[model samples]
Target chain A: MGFRSLKTKLLLAASLLVISSGVALSLLVSDQYSKSLIDSARHQAENLALSLAIESADKVLTHDLVALQKSLDHQMKSNRSLAYLFVVRDGQVLAHTFQKNFPQELLDANTVISEDGGNEQTIVSTTGERFIDIARPIFQGKAGLLRLGISEKSLERQVDELRMKMGLITLFILLTAIAGSLFLVKRITGPLGELARSVENIKQGSWDVKIRVSGRDEVTILAKSLINMAARLKHYTQRLENQKLELERAHNQTRIFCEIVRELGTV
Target chain B: MLFSITSIKPIAIFRVSLIIITALSNIGCSDHEQSKVVNFSNTITLEKPDTKQRGDKQLRVAIGAMVSPRESISIYQELLDYLGEKLGKEIVLEQRKTYSEINELLGKSEVDFAFVCSGPYVVGKEKYGLELLAAPEVNGSHFYNAYLIVNKDSRFNTIEDLRSKTFALTDPDSNTGKLAPIGWLKKIGEKPETFFGSLIYTYSHDNSILAVSRGFVDGASVDGLIWAYFNKTNPDLTSNTRVILKSENYGTPPVVATRQMSKSMKEAIKRALLGMRDDKRGAEILDRLMINRFVPAKDDWYNSIRDVIESAGVSMEPQDGLSKSEN
Candidate 1:
């Protein structure tokens, strides 16, 4: 391809850089936010699970199943993020807040109580939705364990919001960069455009062609130099035309004198 | 550059369109409905051990709750203070509504000592090795009975007349409120649950009395000493209640310490309690508690209460509360 205009090259380079950086920034921010969102959700889930475990221990010890069920129902009602809560004893579910029987998979005695009661795991519900399960051992199995399930729906919403915000920010920066780049390209290309027009006028035999670009930059200086060179070329062409006219007149005089001298010799 | 403004002009639209596309894609994601997760039990927070050692590690003690925390604190405040002064350790008092809770607390060695009923003492000793520290001598009496009470307006005169009517019991681990009734039921060739229309657990002996007086229940079983003390000092709450039946005398509750207590600490507490009758401050505390002195604890003193529990044929069996479904 023919060489692209200076303005086109500069504009493409600046735009590419700005757009790529914005995209990169948006991706970085989105990743960081998703991670923090998950971490925050997990932290909250762990805390809530531990709370449920300790609170239900006494009721389980006293065999207050009705009270335990009532309190569990209340907690579930109050907090929508909670998916399920249960108290397990002797490898059996003593009480649970699930509408159905306890999940049989969770009934496996393999529930490992993580240190700090943060034993969390991701589970897929029968409906295929993702959830976080937090299991806390109740006083070393003196009674049972308290298990809580937190839905990922809230975390999904948070991540979406973060992504939207990041998108808006990137767009704002990209738009601003594009607008500023147009103004800068115009500043450099405006004078160059004027210089090209002046050079065209000189080629078309207008000797008084002058470029009037108003700037102190290199483009304006190039315009000024082009105007000076055009003026000198016009002056030299007028002098050469005068000299050719004079030489034609001198040759005609010499021819007429030779014709008169031949007529005198014949007489 | 200005000549082909239109060719390059569409890029503005393209750039805006790309931004719009990105923004829309991000904003398109919305919160969706989640599946319902059923929960079964209440959640409680687990507290971790503090890295910073407590400046004043208290010798925690739980007092008997035949009375309210206020009254129990009053009755044992001076004695606990005297014990604390003698032991040279800060005293922390805890109280639970049920003897079962206290028993478990002592069983788990969460507290140093507990003033609990004779029934709890024996049961805990059998289960958790609880040791008797000392027994309080109230009016020079080391024994008391279970009082079966009814509202004053009731026409029933004896335990036999309360047939098929609702009755309240205190803690399952209570001697006067639970074991005595069970023993009486056993002697009459009846079951406690079937004898009463419904057996309600009031959790505390005082709560049982309140339940009966408030007409929430037809009758209740409580400690005779607690009822007598209330009958004298707190007439308003007990004016409508009367003891309809009383069981054979049994030993009063003893100040028992968990087996985990150090020998020196136990001896220091025993010495402080036994010497309370000699000190002016201690004597004043004893007078307020309505006790003459504290005598040494004996496992034999509670043998009669154990006999009552054994006679009642009470079985503390662990069971799954939920009934399984069989197809």
Candidate 2:
């Protein structure tokens, strides 16, 4: 039973190690991937803002509102990661791709005005959608400013997918590791389990217990050594039993002689 | 002995299991704390504009629509503030869609002074006695050129290749944008309406460059200085367009004032502009605008512009009250 429980403990230890390491590895992988994806997303947003700034420079300088609106609309349609975009000059909005009224709050949401060149920031909209607001200056803020809101939803979705995949992989690894550990534990403890049972029977005075040893490992050698010890113990016990019977017979004779001597003396 | 051994083994196993459980739980807790510590809030430092009280007199300075109004404001705001500080008066910036309107404001003395294109300076000088106050010295020269450009991918090698193709021109009152191109076409014995399939007035040199770059037009004539500036500052757009021809250099645009302004005010304003490069803040502003310094303007520098307009047979007529949309 003790050996059986030892196998259980060994299996438990193996499982704990596998579970902990697997989870840690999966978490680490997913976290790194998430960070990289977000960084690339930011880079993409910055590039898009710069391109838009270049395109909008001419439109803004000429006050070509129609062409500016067309460009903004076309960009919105082409880039799905774009949530919204707009051009602002001298505190006046030139054009925007919003379907409804442009949000007044967004104007102050990002503090990087055109004079600061290009920069990005994470912002949450009134609708609770997250975005990276990127700003690029047109003509060094002389012509106007172009602002793009790159949605984080797609990045989040991608990270979630990676996490899910990592989770599944970790689970598969854990299960496989556990199965392997179980088989290993059984192989290591099989002989020891039989030895334990034989010792238990010997303790109960059953010396005829058969010990079958197998393998070239230390366990097999240990079982062979225990078999020798059990045989020697059985022989010693048989000899001791015969000596005890003789001693009893001698005691009976001594008692009878003592009684006969006492009677003769009395006569 | 067996009881003790079995008891000790189970205890040892139990202790190891407990340690693992504790270590895993610790890992989980640390992960939670680390995640909680990650902050996503973003902010920046923005300088607030000054709101100081000003004197009763305000100097209304009109900036011509050479670039966009917003751009003009940003490029000139610091310089205007510097001038206002020197003059001890508040400066109010005014903008108009056409260069002629700004000229009219200067002509009427409605504005204290104005920035006008070389062509408008020529016309305003003839029409309204608009006196030159100062001119920006770019690369140590008070002159700029007209650039005839096409999309880099286009096979057009010269102005002749643009025949029967859409062409973009800047403002009608622009020297490099209009008269120079017209003079080039005249030299080739062609007229704008007859030589090109279509023509568009982009109202600004940057816009004209963009038109050509985006393939909205087959070719365009723009200010060489603006093209060079964009090429240096923003190559993404300028790189898409190739300059095929560069016209002879003409006088750069000059800051002019009406004849009615007192001589002392003009002298003081000219001194302020000429001395800008020596001042820390003013020099920084000039550097940002790619200007070397402000120099004294001579009427002779603009004679080439007058010659181009005359030779091209282009009218110096100011389309008064015309908005950008009409162009």
The DockQ leader among the candidates is 2
**Global lDDT scores for all candidate models:** 0.74, 0.79
CAPRI class of candidate 2: incorrect
- lDDT per residue as tens, model 2, B1-327: 355443335456556656655664454345321111111233222222222233357777888887766557666788898999988777877677678778887887778898888999999999999999999999989998889999999999989999989888777788887788788988889987788887777777778887888998899888888888889877987999998999988999999998988899899899999999999988998998899999999999999988987787787543333223332
Root-mean-square deviation of candidate 1: 13.5
Q: Model 2: residues >4 Å from true position, as ranges? A: A1-25, A50-71, A86-96, A113-121, A124-129, A134-147, A216-218, A245-267, B1-82, B89-113, B121-171, B181-189, B192-252, B256-327
Q: What is the per-residue lDDT of model 1 for residues B1-327, given as tens digits with 9 covering 90 to 100?
A: 456542344356457646754664454244443333322233333222122232355788886556654556545677788888877888866666567778888988777898888778888899999988888887678988899899999997888888888888776677897788888888889877778777777666667778888998899889888887777778877889988889987888888988888998899888888998998988887877777888997788788887876776775421123121100
Superposed Cα deviation of residue A40, candidate 2 (Å) = 2.6
Across A2-35, the per-residue lDDT of candidate 1 in tens digits comes to 2256677667756665665566566666766766
Q: How does each model score on TM-score?
A: 0.47, 0.64
Task: Write one digit per residue (lDDT tens) for candidate 2, span A1-267.
Answer: 444477877877776666666666656666677668878988888888888888777567645678789999999889998888988776667788777555666765564544757867777655566787877888688666788888778888887898788778878887898899889989888878888899999999988768777678999888888898889999999999999989999999999999999999999
For model 1, the superposed segments whose C-alpha errors exceed 4 Å read: A1-267, B1-57, B68-71, B316-327
| Model 1 docking category | incorrect
Candidate 2, pairs of clashing residues: A142-B71
